[model samples]
Target: MKKNLFFALLLTFGAFATSFAQAVNDTVYVTINRLPVKVNPIASRDSVYAGQSVNLTVTNCIGTVNWNNGLTGGSVTINPTTTRYYVAQCTSSAGCVGAKDSVRVVFKSLISPIATSASICFNESTTLTAPSTCTGGTITWSNNSTGGSITVSPTSTTTYTYTCTYTGSGTSNASGNLTVQVKPRPLAPTLVANPASILTGASSTITASNCSGTISWTKPDGTPITTGVSGSSLTITPTATTTYLAYCTTNGCSGPSASQEITVDSPIPSVAFSAPQICQGDPITITASGCSGTYVWSSGQTTPAITVTTTLSNYTVNVLCRTTAGDSAPKKIKFKLN
Candidate 1:
């Protein structure tokens, strides 16, 4: 009967089909003469992603066709996470199997992407980066720019957004946002040194102003202070003239500075005598001069002048001046009276 089925198939391919039904021992047999069934080597698609389906088609099968999985159909739809083969086996009405073919459907793996970044300071820049996995798709930023990495220098706190779309096999998109914080910068301080002129060994008061916060002092008394005191006022006892500078900073940003100079002076003491005043039952007077300070006399006096009635042939007196800064080191003048 199978031999006759092959002859029947030839006749069907030539023009029309031929079928013969016969019953024997409660078993019935029929014949189907038609074109051989062939599974199309080409598929709806060569490859598909997980949960994605593809159609497998076959043509010209006699009566009906059976897939390897026992499903009966001329076409099959398959969705597999892994590679799969859908085979079609054509059977004749006589129960004789004939002609077989298969098609392969590949599954692709899924991919996801992410973005990264950091914070920044005022006048400072930072690099923002994202994955380059757009895969023939467009990548756009909040600034309406396209690319993988970008540099930004924001004056204040800011937030940026990004999006990546992939058109591979399927449409995929990744999006995220980044924020950069900005720290403020400090301002320069104004300095004022009261009593700009001081005597040697005297202290001068330097004050700071016009700053956002605490101020730092520098260059006091002609000496550089690497780490200085933090305050608005600084008192310095300088032996010589010097310049003082002040400024403030925050978030590693520096501002302009203001300075004040102090001048120091040292004065000598002297005395004025009456060119040897005659003492014949007469009085002699000596006065302190030359320096704007307290005076000391040899007669144990603190006044600037002294009087005496000695009547001695030669009377000598000495004096010195004491200022706020220091005592006079020289000019201890001596005067004689006759």
Candidate 2:
């Protein structure tokens, strides 16, 4: 009984010692709650058209965590115009964890207006204007004119500038320049026989008014007419019944256009026969009427009357006639054989 009690006491003490050692040897870890990230220029920072970049840094971290760019380190570079987010996590030696922080980078552009020119007539005044965004800045005109807008009576090509100022952002400025090209207005052309209508194969003339250069004419079908005619008039001949277009072109500028319609009358030829009915071996005559030109038969006969001997049940004669003016129609004659 004495030996058994001694063994039980040793087992109870051994269990207590093991539990106390484990509790003392365990480690406690610390973590950062949340760190804030910020970009140097806040959000939008306008620069020139060349290019620019913004800097970003991290703050609100008690200790340095794993400075990773999400992959490994905590720093990232990006274009200012582009939107991007920076992520960083904090890790402590005591095994503490922290939330990632994000910062946005943006770019705003401050550039001058592109140079442009407009055409104006002689003795006409043109206004030189700047872009609408050119505000809060004083315009230093290159032509000695002040303010964001300027007026000038230019007989030739002239250039002017407007320097814009942004008082809120110090001496930042944007320049806008414009050129005015002075030119005389083109003279309108005179259309001769304007809006004329004729039959097919007919022609009309159109003249250019006050034109110092060579005149050119374009038909509605995009066919160009010969400009070497006797005078300023252009003769437009249409082969087919079509709407013709006439325009005077000089010095790369075209005048007002005019159109004419040519109606071709190709009426069906009137036909007649000497004998409506004939017996076999009887002679029949086919005639074409109401046509001005010489008659042509399908049987190779060109006379107005063709004498034919009938043998079949019926005979059909077709005559085609064309006038000198290209007016044409077809005629037919039928003779019944009994």
Best by lDDT: 1
Write model 2 residue lDDT over 101-130, tens digit each, in one string.
554443344444443336666667767666
Give me candidate 1's TM-score against the actual structure.
0.43
The TM-score between candidate 2 and the true structure equals 0.35
- Most accurate candidate by TM-score: 1
Q: Tell me how many residue pairs clash in candidate 1.
A: 0
Residue by residue across 256-336, what tens digits does model 1's lDDT show?
A: 677888877555555666655554666667676766667777778888778866654544566666665456665554334
lDDT of each: 0.66, 0.57
The collision pairs in model 1 are: none
